[model samples]
Target: MRAVEDYANDDDAAPLDMLAALFEARGWPCSVRGHEVSGEVRGSWAKYQVKGIWRADDRVLQILCLPEVRVPDDKLGAAYELLGTINEQLWLGHFDIWSNGGVLLYRNATMLGDDGTLGLSQAQALVEIAVEECDRFYPAFQFVLWGGKSPADALEAAMVDPAGEA
Candidate 1:
């Protein structure tokens, strides 16, 4: 157990350092950006840039994963609908389409307490969810972004079991 005083230190808010150590220990490469950490993860469809941002004021650690698919202006509506449907299927973090840039980001967060450092398992889970979710859905995103597929159709195509049926 950690002392309560540790929480009061501003360094306690530096989640990137902790995450970087964890990544290094696991032999993963990452780029540290101030209070954030970004790394590359290979998914089934593509590799993603996964970034972790720590907000001290909010006591939250946020992980954002970016796939290769970038939504064009004309496809914004389908992308929005795709996100809405896909988000419901996710048990952890969901996708966010930035309005200005039309960038799709996979996001998840964990609230850090003022009493102790975030547990390694908890920190690990946040990173895992970001990667797994992005890998699982990257193809669906591509379908919407470039294939001219409807959200429902894309999601249906994505959810199909490859080994089960055609």
Candidate 2:
């Protein structure tokens, strides 16, 4: 078997380059720096900042979406509990809290495997999934953080889908 580095692209364009292009095409503001591309995505709940980082050595692309929700020190335990509940409901990626900062975010990673190439649609999907998950669960974080709702209750409240338009 060959090493992962053997599959790295010989050109200057990296996986994040694809993300930058996709973000541009979607009209989401973004900046590219080295192997990373950071952008702002608008969700139903709120706007989020997404970062796409490319690792050539592992042939992996990691997407991090911050919902801009900060958990208070007093709500840390409940926040963690909520994270567990939220993550359990997710099938693709997982929700996480930055321990030091108490910031909430959704994270997912895709391995490019031997080819080490990331398609435009794949890049679009990664960002869409991260943003969608964060938006879908943002209210739960709010319920637990400020509304004084338990993790289970908050999840239940936020997970309900509304029927036909009013």
Candidate 3:
């Protein structure tokens, strides 16, 4: 087995740099600090705070997209249930609520393999997926937390796709 120091010492910030660049190219406000890149993206329902972290040891790039909605104390259980329902419809990442603050977020990750090189397209896809999913499900979260709808009902109400712009 490799020494702990060997595993901990080698960390590359390039992946996060690429993510920051991607955000800048798209005109999204992003800040890069060490191994993390964080910024905000506007979705249909709300503006989301998006953060990207590079875990060099695991060769993983993780992204978190946090919506503006907060789950109240009484709605925690329903919110959790809605997460399960929403996650099932997701093809890429899943939604989760923070245990400490009851704040909702979408989490997703991609492995860069042994080479540890994250392509621009891959980086773009990761952020795009997070933003898209958050936009798609933000209303469902509202339906559960504010509308007092069941998970099933919230999903149904939020997923209605109308045919064209009005």
Candidate 4:
């Protein structure tokens, strides 16, 4: 793993390196593992594991968001339904639950184009979008898994604008 400073100094570093530097510059503690940069981010609901991976050939930056909780077996169906609906509402990322562990994750990506010059601001926004999307839909997962609410109801509640809160 290269130091974040190394990435910061090299304008021609790989996508992963640039992302790590950008994240570090913004005070996010990220470590480069192989080709991915991962860190922990705190959200309104819980802590989330965030990973950034760069596909050099594709000029893509993939950001993944993973929450700490696991979805119970009984709630798998509801969780899947919520993921589908919530994914539709999202503009930048999609929610998916792992089949093996029933763990929900949010994924989004930014295309750096053929030239592979990704601006610092764009990279930061890509990572930020993944985390924000996870925090936004996290309550729906709680509702389905623990509150025993239907997927539709949970999604509705999550989307609703609470009165007098602004």
Global lDDT of each candidate = 0.76, 0.83, 0.81, 0.78
Largest lDDT belongs to which candidate?
2
**lDDT of candidate 4 at residue 82, scale 0 to 100:** 82
The model with the greater lDDT, 1 or 4, is: 4
Off by over 4 Å in 3: 1-13
Query: Pick by TM-score: which candidate is best?
Result: 2
Give lDDT tens digits, candidate 2, residues 3-94: 22322333223577677767777789989888888999899989999999888999988999998988889999999998887788889989
Q: Least lDDT summed over 10 consecutive residues: which range in candidate 4?
A: 3-12
Taking the tens digit of each residue's C-alpha lDDT, what string does model 1 give over 46-138?
778878888878888888988866788889889899899999988888899887777889988778888535655566778778888888888
lDDT of 2 at 58: 94
Q: Return the TM-score for candidate 3, rounded to 2 decimals.
A: 0.88
What residue runs in model 4 are displaced by over 4 Å at the alpha carbon? 1-13, 163-166
Please give each candidate's TM-score. Answer: 0.83, 0.89, 0.88, 0.85
